[model samples]
Target: MTGALFEVTFYLAAPFWALMIVAPRWRWTTRVIGSPWIALPPLLVYLTLAPGDFAELWTVVSRPDLEALRAFLSSADGAAMIWAHLIAFDLFIGRWMYLDARRRGVPHLALAPVLVLTILLSPIGLLAYLLVRAVTPEARRLHDREREDQPAQ
Candidate 1:
């Protein structure tokens, strides 16, 4: 039950991920991502897992204690909730990165691998995006504009 939803969570998001990564500039890809509903499936999974154990969920989140938190996450439902949460956030972040990259003229070839890293390990992937973003012409231009606007003695 929960396991199936757990697997389905990622499966549901895969198509959106594929479209954003594979056809970022395509009209349909932009159309699909434009709507906020791309996050609904994973959020639904989180809703399913969360209310099942509200007391534990509340405790795990509201009051931070290591031992209790560890026990809570060790449960199947806890794991599912976290998994769905991760999937939803990762998808949203990937979508943002994709659009931002497109706006900045970052090459699709450069972004494909970074998006994959985001799917697998979001923090590292975000760090990579930040590194790339620093070197992007858009960012450089923005920086130059800001520097020019500064007052000199």
Candidate 2:
């Protein structure tokens, strides 16, 4: 069951990722991603796997011990739970990146690679998007305009 859940976790997130990366400009893509609840299914899996050993899970997280954390994650259930957590958050982040990039007028060509990177390594993908967003003309112009409108501090 744990193995199956782990496998299914990525499958659940894959369609969303596909929409964001493949058919990014499609009307259906925007409509589907418009709902942030897309992240819920994997989270449900996480919740299901969590109750099995809540005490160990809590202890591993609440304390700073390396070995305890290692032991907890070494278990099948623990690994599966973490995988679901990662999938849910990654999809959420990808959704935000897609919507924000489109709004900022960052071309889909540039955003596609970053979205792909997010699937493999989200922190790095987020960093890359930040750099891209920072340099994008529309995004920078919008930021400057917003700053100008703010009351002087």
Candidate 3:
């Protein structure tokens, strides 16, 4: 049922989050996270739910009317569709953050909490990660090194 699908959407993404947060140092984590498809399950749910209400959704999106959007979101199906969409994008964002952190040699300790925050509140989590990324010595050093390696104009 729609309710069950709504409830299970987050579960579909939980394992990938577990790998990124709980087993970040594991070699398989990187291997597994390498595929951007990790976000596909919830996205599939979004796809499944979208066509049922495509007309209304298109209207809500295209016109940007506050009352119309509120009405759209008031329905169970609309809420579920939006939830699935959020879960998929959040996982995708989290994956990117994890991979970028690893590449920059940002310590796992610093990133773990950020990933958790991303799960709970992505905008804040993204801000926190950006702040961490900006201040991280390794990230700055890598940026400088990469800049130096570029051929001068």
Q: Which candidate number would show the highest lDDT if scored against the true structure?
A: 3
Q: List model 3 lDDT by residue over 36-100, tens digit each.
A: 99999999999999999999999999999999999999999899999999999999999999999
Model 3 stretches with alpha carbons more than 4 Å out: 149-153
For each candidate, what TM-score against the reference?
0.89, 0.95, 0.95
Better of 2 and 3 by lDDT: 3
lDDT tens digits, residue span 1-153, model 2: 899999999999999999999998899999999999999999999999999978898998888699997888899998899899999999999999999998888888889999999999999999999999999998888878979999998
- Which of 1 and 2 is the better model by TM-score? 2
Candidate 3: lDDT over CA atoms?
A: 0.95
Candidate 1 global lDDT: 0.88
Q: Using alpha carbons, what is the TM-score of model 2?
A: 0.95
Candidate 2 residue-wise lDDT at 144: 86
Q: Which 10-residue window of candidate 2 scores lowest in summed lDDT?
A: 60-69
For 32-144, candidate 1 gives per-residue lDDT tens digits of: 98877898999999998888888998988899999998898899999899999999999888888887787766778878899999999998988898778778787667667
Q: On lDDT, who's better, 1 or 2?
A: 2
Q: CA lDDT of each candidate? A: 0.88, 0.93, 0.95
CA lDDT, candidate 1, residue 4: 96
